[model samples]
Target: MTRFYWRKYRSLGVVTTLAILYLIVRAKNYEHKAFVFLANVHPSEPWEFVADFSNMKYLNPTIIDFNLLDESGDYVHWKYSLEYSEKLSHWPHSYNTAVAHFNIKASPKKDSYFIHSTHKTCLLFGLYCLNSVSEFKFSHGNSSKGASCEEHIQYQCPTVLSSFCRREVVYQRKAIMNNLFKKFDGRKF
Candidate 1:
């Protein structure tokens, strides 16, 4: 009877281990989002704005500080500090600051320019982390009246926090675009 009980417990442990591994693998899968928008300006105008790393703080308000670490040819390495807060049920409100690193490359095509960027941020000593790849395509508008931009982003994070991360990504991207338009329309760009 003791041997039988031991075998049963071993089987249960194996199953539990497998379940945890599956959850970790599933949670690490990347999620993707794509969007397009039109702006009343030339493609080069928006391309210039995005290619300049110094303009990032103006484009994203959450970015409290930005620094360009290095630049070589078409590639740029930069880092920034992002400030955010979270309020969870039955928990104290928390304000946090995260530092993220970025590697970006700009490629110019015949009629469009592409900005490809990879972002990495880890929290709690790498216990929780987020990584993302973003591609931005800038070209002439379909109606020939202005410019059009296509943005594709893929990100991975823990399963429990995926929804919150996804919402924040979408919100930030939209805010950046709106700010971009406002800048150009106000003739501040």
Candidate 2:
């Protein structure tokens, strides 16, 4: 009788584990909002910076390459690779590299310009449960010389995991912005 019960429980355990794995691998529903950072630059400067694919390699230290695939009017398609760097080598997902496709839109009106970017990884099970969209709104600054740019990065994932990882995601976004600001050489509009 004990042997019989043991086998039943073992089968149940295996099924349960498989179900959890499936949820983790296929969940894909999360939204995270980070603290917005405003940059001192011209509204056009920020939108133009991201529109040019080559600028990513300079703005972001971890990004080694960004290839432009297509551009039609305000829409742009590009693929980028994040390489292993000393700063990311120790993180859980850092060892796993990602090549992702970005769909970007550049919208400029009378007073402001917005850059919207949505991305998905090339691999099916890319990073398990986390996906994100980043938007930057640049408006003419009150000062005649400089413009103000606001960044909002949102991360989406399964509910359980989103709660656990929200803070980390926010911190990561802030770090990215800080890095960009440090690398960017102020360009005159």
Candidate 3:
């Protein structure tokens, strides 16, 4: 019985190793672009909220929000929080807080989407997150240290700045959408 079990276990390990190789090959473009937005998303959404792209080195961005337990074992829904690094007082450091802080528990009234919403208009800014199934928001442009959330840009030409947290507004479509739904359409689209 022991010999039989070992044979099966060895085969399983080999299969898992092959799968990891495939993933690494597919991640070639990950470093090319960085994003930040909602920290998590609803199970219904395709891509869970991705707050940063730096974390990509250790994380595999997923659109599927599932029940997971962190080191504490508490049921915390963790979405793609753009895994990146920064200088802490001039020291290099990785951060996913900007991505983790974004919580979109409202909007579309559903837990879905992976990209960020620049505004209430559902603009494709960067990433999106949903905790319950209500609120939702997006982040765009690059981010830098000492940069304010609304003042930093999450993306720069599809490349997320890896300097500091510079949460800048990349999309104003939300304002336009609000006005359109509010019987106001004088603003540009």
Highest lDDT: give the candidate number.
1
Give the Å error, residue 42, model 2: 2.3
Per-prediction tally of clashes:
0, 4, 53
Please, what are the lDDT tens digits per residue for candidate 1 over residues 1-189? 999999999999999999987675455656555444554677767777876756766776555455455455533332333333222222224322344343333444446666777666555544565667778777774646566766788887777667766776776777678777777762221
Native-to-model Cα distance after best TM-score fit, residue 74 in candidate 3, in Å: 13
Which pairs clash in model 1? none
- Stronger candidate by TM-score (1 vs 2): 1
**What ranking of all candidate models by TM-score puts the best one first?**
1, 2, 3
lDDT of every predicted structure (CA atoms): 0.60, 0.52, 0.27
Residues 40-154, candidate 2: write the lDDT tens digits. 5565665667556576655454454444554455333333333222123224454223433444444434466665666543223343424557776666665555556566766
Models ranked on lDDT: 1, 2, 3
Worst 10 residues of 2 by lDDT: 81-90
User: What is the TM-score of candidate 1?
Assistant: 0.67
* Model 2 local distance difference test score: 0.52
Per-residue error (Å), model 1, residue 173: 1.0
List candidate 3 segments past 4 Å from native.
Answer: 1-45, 49-100, 106-108, 111-153, 156-189
Question: What RMSD value applies to candidate 1?
Answer: 5.6
What does the lDDT read for residue 29 in candidate 1? 50
TM-scores of all predicted structures:
0.67, 0.62, 0.18
Using lDDT as the measure, name the better of candidate 1 and candidate 2.
1
Candidate 1 ranges with C-alpha deviation above 4 Å: 1-26, 32-39, 74-110, 186-189
